[model samples]
Target: MNGADVIDIARDAVYTLLIVSGPTMAIGLGVGLLIALFQALTQIQEMTLTFVPKIIAIFLALVLFMPMMGAQMGDLMARLMDRVATGG
Candidate 1:
């Protein structure tokens, strides 16, 4: 592939990664922030408190957004395959 084609593919890959991961990451961030706030307010500064809730929230986010993530990934893969097949 030419430099432009390579750059396009790299851009798409990064975009696809962000799209697939954004929801879970956002959930984790939100949950972590809330847990931190709760700890600050309640003085319950247990490390596990933050970890468990963030994990659960991220898991839930993944479950909820799995279909959209899958579709996005599949679309990206198809586009990549097309590019490969056509010699970019």
Candidate 2:
């Protein structure tokens, strides 16, 4: 493939990655912010307090978003495969 083709493929890959991971990342961010707020209010500066809740929230997000993620990934894979098949 040419440089342009390589760049396009890379862009698509990154976009796909972001789309697939966005939900979990957003959930983690929201959870972290809430935990930080709680700590600020309670004056409890426990580092591990952030980890468990963030992990649980992210895990739940992942589970909830799994079907959407799978569809996005499958679409990307199909596109990539089609490009490869056509020697794009």
Task: Give the poorly placed runs of model 1, Cα more than 4 Å off.
Answer: none
What lDDT, from 0 to 1, does candidate 1 have?
0.91
Q: What TM-scores do the predictions have?
A: 0.95, 0.95
Q: Taking the tens digit of each residue's C-alpha lDDT, what string does model 2 give over 54-88?
A: 88888889889999999999998999999989988
Please report the TM-score between candidate 2 and the true structure: 0.95
Model 1 clash tally, residue pairs: 0
Give all candidate RMSDs, comma-separated: 0.8, 0.8
- Across residues 1-88, which tens digit of lDDT does each residue of candidate 1 receive? 7899999999999999999998899889888888899999999978788878887888889889999999999999999999989986
Best model per TM-score: 1
Model 2 RMSD vs true structure = 0.8
TM-score, structure 1 vs. true: 0.95
Best by lDDT: 2
